[model samples]
Target: MRRFLIDAIVYVRDLALGFSRGWSRFFFLPADPTPLGLIRALVGVLGFWSLFVIGLDLHDYLGSQGWSDAAGAYDAMPPFGWSLWFYVPDSLLRVAWLASLAVFASMAVGLFSRTTSILAWIVIVSTVRRIPIALFGFDQILSTMALYVAVSGASGRAVSLDRLLKRWREARRNAAVVRPKGARKVSPDGPGRPEPSVGANIGLRLLQLHLAFIYGMAGLAKLRGPSWWTGMALWGTMNAGEFAWLDFTWLAAWPMVLNLLTHGSLALEIVYPILIWFRLTRPLMIAGAVALHLGIAVMSPGLAEFGVAMIVANVAFVSGTWLRSLVAGRDDEQPALRVLYDGACPRCRASMALATAADPDRVVEPIDLTAIDVKTIHPSLTAEACLRSMHVVSRSGKVESGYDAVTRIGSRLPLFRPLALLGRLPGVVQAGRVAYNRIASSRPRDAVCTDETCGIHPPVSVTGAASRTRDSSAI
Candidate 1:
């Protein structure tokens, strides 16, 4: 009995620890600020658009002579919230409206980003509170996005004046400082700013989780309505004169298609909250969300704004690295042959020099593993693995190592293409791999094994000696 109780206690403790670790990783894992920055920029644009929409009727809605006077606006406020428009005079209200526009502009450009974000949130809340009837999910989503962007450190990363200015300053700094002999050139912008708080991660996690909750609740609400289950909900939704853009009464002609869409939408919404949490199912669920939202935007007329707002919000849940690469236009261009080599290896350095000299146009990009952080560029390739063997990352994002990497590089150059082609023929390929393995195994270990900097200060004589020694090894 004693032994069983002890084992049970240990099991419970282990389970608790596992749960706690998982919770921490889910909510507080460090993230690149890129996604958060994208959210900030998008929310800024939407906030400005919302303000512009309100500006057209600013006088009609908030002016003293208009529908809601100051006193009437004050009375309309909910018991829990406040509105600046209520207490201010008509002229002050106009000034506030203009000031809100300025705040939105600043937030959009990421000038004083966090501060502007706070001001933007206040402007949104105050204006919406004054006109509670105007409030919708768009307002709520904007406010929520603003709240998180204000808390996060995403303001200075990219597509912002702040980032540009930082880059300019770093460029000037790099120019002023004279680097030591054989010093590895650091990125002009230097190391990334360490996140003071896990706010970016927490904010993104909250966006993802809250969106899931919203989808789940929406699905449950649809279950309560008879039309949804009958697959006729879309019929009513489309036929409503106020919400329908076109005469969707014609949709009655295709009952089967309408029913499939209605039922399929509900099924996706219900399953999304559960499936989005896992790695494998996440892409599928996100794609489904994009389709669902885009369909609503395209097929349903009046709800396009709502659908688009949801789609933009969904951007927060996407992986930052993937988004960054996409934004960098890696997908649009032809792939380059990225040569990943150990800088400390004399033969490797000599080979890189030879390749570059052979092709002055610079098609092959040499990546010194000693200088670059592989994690940022290619998360899958670790420094230890790169140190062990040469790696060739093809433009198509495929990784080739050992003799295959050599052949890939050689095939890309005009001078060596024939030799590379010959090396690939049947039994010749096997012999090349064997020779490559022996050469790799016999190469001396560089300072990269101990300290990454050791490769940067190789003896001058070593370069010449390594070039001569390389005649014996396969290039």
Candidate 2:
């Protein structure tokens, strides 16, 4: 028992280290101590907890009663029962249940993430307490996970409004300061400078440890069971018609196949932790786990949902480095093109800058037409033509003007790959380019607005000419 516990601790420690390494690389954080790394850890911990709460609610909803009966029970639960703090009416309970679902949904989107996480925990706990008889071990696990999420800051990245607000604030600060002539300008850093809290790191480490414990306990439980040791559990479960609601009934008809699947299932389950422990076999083990869950879903009527939840949770096991590399590879493929753009035209310059920023390896270069030598690169394209719209010189030295340039640039970036592909389709590219040209040409020559703030520009007609001129000057 002591040996098993020690092995479990070592395995979990390695997994945590893997997670830390992957996330640190993904966010481009410095090794050892980093604010971004700490944030990543916090977010991961919160995500795990959020998923746990969601899984518990789902399990409770599905486990106790049939679909129709559960619906009736949902309706029957008091809105504000005596068990609740305020002696809330029975209708309030129903509302709280619905609210819990909404909170979970919000958490998934990172909207009011912290508040939603808390609400989800409260609702889940209340619902579970209201009907203790119907709860399962999984439900308890989920509740505990939600509690963890409520205390951690997990939704601090791509999915959340919090990150967007932080970015906006940073941009505002950058714009507020005017650099003096000949003065060294300090670049405005990205997002909030939230200090890394040790509590957050400890919380995340605890959750990872708990997950390892769950796996170890599950393995131990299976070892102690007779059907698992004898290889009959899987066969019997698969062949049982009462549980088999899907097309897996065919397995019932084949004795040899059933026996093979049964033995395979037991062998795999017993050795799953071993495979997960070894870095080389981890992928195979994960794939097998997915297959196992999928099989469970197909063979057993209700067991499939639990299998699905487990599969979702397994995603946490994927190294952050692998995920980052996948995204980075796509970013690198975006068209390697240089655009000679007018930096003085705020809107034009902003778009070019954004494109270049999105693909930082100089995959897309936005050269200031006035500041750089555009004539040397493309003798055919006149400076007047380049000034009229965006001009892109492809990786092969082929020059495309206006909308064609945009499409060419888009094709090279990972995030815009779909748009690039669509640009190549019949008529679509021409139409898009034409539309872009019309919009660009109609804008005031002095207009300075980034894509995000460009809509503030008024019509170029004389009616609002004075105001538009003032706005352009201010920009």
Candidate 3:
């Protein structure tokens, strides 16, 4: 009896420990700022759209002479919540509205990001409170994102004007340093770029937890409905003229497919909240979520924004590195392309692996700049330039660098061709180039040779340099 009691206590202790560890890791682990930055940028755009829609009928929505007069706005407020919009006079309401637009603009560009984010949150929540009748799922999502954006430092990362200003400052500082022509100067610890922090983790964890709660509660609510158990929930949603954009009632002719979709959706919602926390099940859960959300967006009219917001929220749960390497289609077994990479850089190595994985036909000859005879293979290939950026040589003896190299390689890969096509668009091409440069700049410069020794000092012999200049003139 004593042994049984002791065993039970031990089991309880182990369970408690596991729970604590999971919570700690969820709320405290350092998260890459890339996902957070991407989320911030998306939410900012969505926020701007919401504000624009409000701007279209600003006076009708908030003017005292219109539907919700100041007194009526105050009356519409929840019991405990307050709205400053009620206190502002009718004459100043327009001014307040304009101010809110300015705040949203600043938030979108990430100017004074944290402060503007907080101000934007307050403005949005106050607006929602004052005009509760105008609220929709989109407004709720915008408000929720604002809350997290206010708390997070996501705006300081890539894709923001804030980051641009930071890079400019770094450039000015580096110019002042007396480093060698080819060497890099490290930024001072504190004032340099801020490292990932627990706050980022907390913000992402909150988003993930909230999504789990949303799915779990939605699934439970559906379970209470007879339609869900009978596999007619989706059918009802489709047949509802007000909710559906497409006439999926035609699907009634395919009862088995309808049943599969209905039961599948319910099962997915119920399973996602539990299984998503497990590493092995995370990809499956994420895939299910993407499919479910995309289906909703494509099939439902008014709910498209809501579906998009959920997908954006899901971005926080995925690895930013994986997303950066995304290829859209299945791989086609093609002949190998000669790929040049900075083998010493872990990110470069990982990228190479991602691009080459699952393709048996492609032979990847990774040419380490430090170990390669630049003169022998491509007499015009300069080691210094290659080290500074990525390079790829096609079988036809054509060379590509930076964004061109990346896109060319991706175009040959089935999974990345679609993105490659998108990358070629006029405005998108410039943006893609800038983003690629940022990633390339982040690679470590203190790269070691294949022998694991400090790489050979630069300035290859005069003859090699001249040969490179002569052979690479076309590029």
Candidate 4:
């Protein structure tokens, strides 16, 4: 019995330890602050728009003797509800409102980001609490994001004026640092760039959890209604005069289609919270959300802004890596190493994909030699040279070829770095170059080799077929 009791205690302790470790990893792990910055930029626009609209009729709504007095409106709210307008005199109301706009604009641009974020939160809550009668889901989401955005400096760390200023400063500071001649001026990913932060992860996790709870609760509430179960819920929404913009009355003729739409939406909402956590399903769910909210924006004029707010809130789940890929072409995009390779070689294409699939920062940009004229792109590149050897172009104009190119590209990717190191070994590099040349020279130069015509390439170099197989793993 004593041994049994000790075993039970040990098991409980182990279980608790596992739970604590998992929880800490889930929330406290450092993450890129880009998503928070994105959320802040979007929420700032919504807040500024709401405030601008309110500014149009300030006296009629939020003034001391407006339709709803601050005291009466705020009193109905939960305890400790407050508004800056309550203390501001009527004569100075316009001035205070303008100042609030400036604060929101600062938040939007990410100037002194954390300070502006906190101020924006206070402004949103204060105004909303002061005029509770005009509240909507849009207001609620705006307030929610405002609070979360204030939780860390993440809201301004990227996609902000602050980042731009930091870059400008770094450029000036590093102006004297010598760079490779004829090389592209690439900034190293060390300082003056968005670094992963634990606070950013905390802020994003809080928003994600809150958003999932909201969606889950909404789905649960819909299940309580017979209209949703019978697939008539969307029908009611489409028929509503206040919400409907376009004529969805024609949906009456196509009951099956209406049922599909209603049922599909219901299922997606019900499963979104549960399935969105998985990497495999997250993209699909996020896309589904975008479609659903876009439909709401188009169909319902009154809820358009609310739908937009929900979509913006969903941005919290998007990863920094995906975000970088989305902006890959921009002038201010992160520095990337370009791989110039033969498009017709399926093996080479597959090899490049394998090497780059795990890249977190989207640094590898593959340029197919067939698709673009190499002579026009760079002076060192020629059709014959590219055909004879694989080429990698640095961010600066420097070029690496054959075995050197493979190592250069591989070294930059985390998983492939060891392969890069192995290739650079004393004997390995010389043998690799010989095998690479043999493989490259064997390919059909006149016609594109289809998969069936591929295997005929001669392994007749000094390295022989076995060495050819070993060294020709990638282009």
Per-candidate TM-score against the hidden true structure: 0.66, 0.62, 0.68, 0.69
> After aligning candidate 1 to the native by TM-score, how far in Å is the CA of 446 from where it should be?
38
On the 0 to 100 scale, the lDDT of residue 388 in model 1 is: 65
Clashing pairs in 3: 328-415, 329-415
Ranking 1 against 3 by TM-score, winner:
3
- Which has the higher lDDT value, candidate number 1 or candidate number 4? 4
User: In terms of lDDT, which candidate is strongest?
Assistant: 4
lDDT of 2: 0.54
Give candidate 3 misplaced runs (Cα > 4 Å). Answer: 1-18, 181-194, 327-378, 381-475
Where is model 2 more than 4 Å wrong at Cα? Answer: 1-88, 93-98, 131-145, 168-188, 191-204, 239-243, 253-256, 267-278, 330-342, 348-371, 374-386, 390-431, 445-475
User: Number of clashing pairs, model 4?
Assistant: 2
Model 1: per-residue lDDT, tens digit, 1-475?
A: 9999999999999999999999998878777666677777777888888888888998777666666666777776678878766666777876888888888888887777778888888887887777766667778777777777776655545445565455444433332222333222212343322232377787787888888988999999999999998998888877777776767788799999889989989998999899988899988888888998887776665566677778877877787656644423233443367788765554676566555433313356677676677766576888767776788887778898889999888776555779999999999999999998777655653332333523222333333322232222222
- Model 4 error, position 143 (Å): 1.0
Displacement of the residue 268 alpha carbon in candidate 3, Å: 1.3
Please give the lDDT score for candidate 3: 0.68
Best by TM-score: 4
Cα lDDT for residue 248, candidate 1: 78
lDDT of 4 by residue, 1-475 (tens): 9999999999999999999999999999998988888899888888888899899999887798888976677577778768877888899999989988998998888788889999999999888878888888889988988899998667777767776555544432332122333111222234433788888898899999988888888888999999889887889888898889898999899888778878888888899999889999999988988888888888897788888999998999998756755644233444457777764453555455454443435566666676577876678887767756678887778889987898887777654678889999999999999987777767433234433433334333222221222222222
Each model's lDDT: 0.69, 0.54, 0.68, 0.74
lDDT of 3 by residue, 1-475 (tens): 9999999999999999999998888788887665676677777767777777777887787776567776777876778887777777778977887787788888777677778778888887888888888787778877887788778755445345675565444433432233333222222212212346677777777888887888898898999999888888888888888888778878989888888998999999999899988999998888898899888887786788778888888887887555443422212312345677664444565455455442212433445554565555566777766776788876667777888888877786554678889988899889988998877765443323321232234321122221221211110
Whole-model lDDT, model 4: 0.74
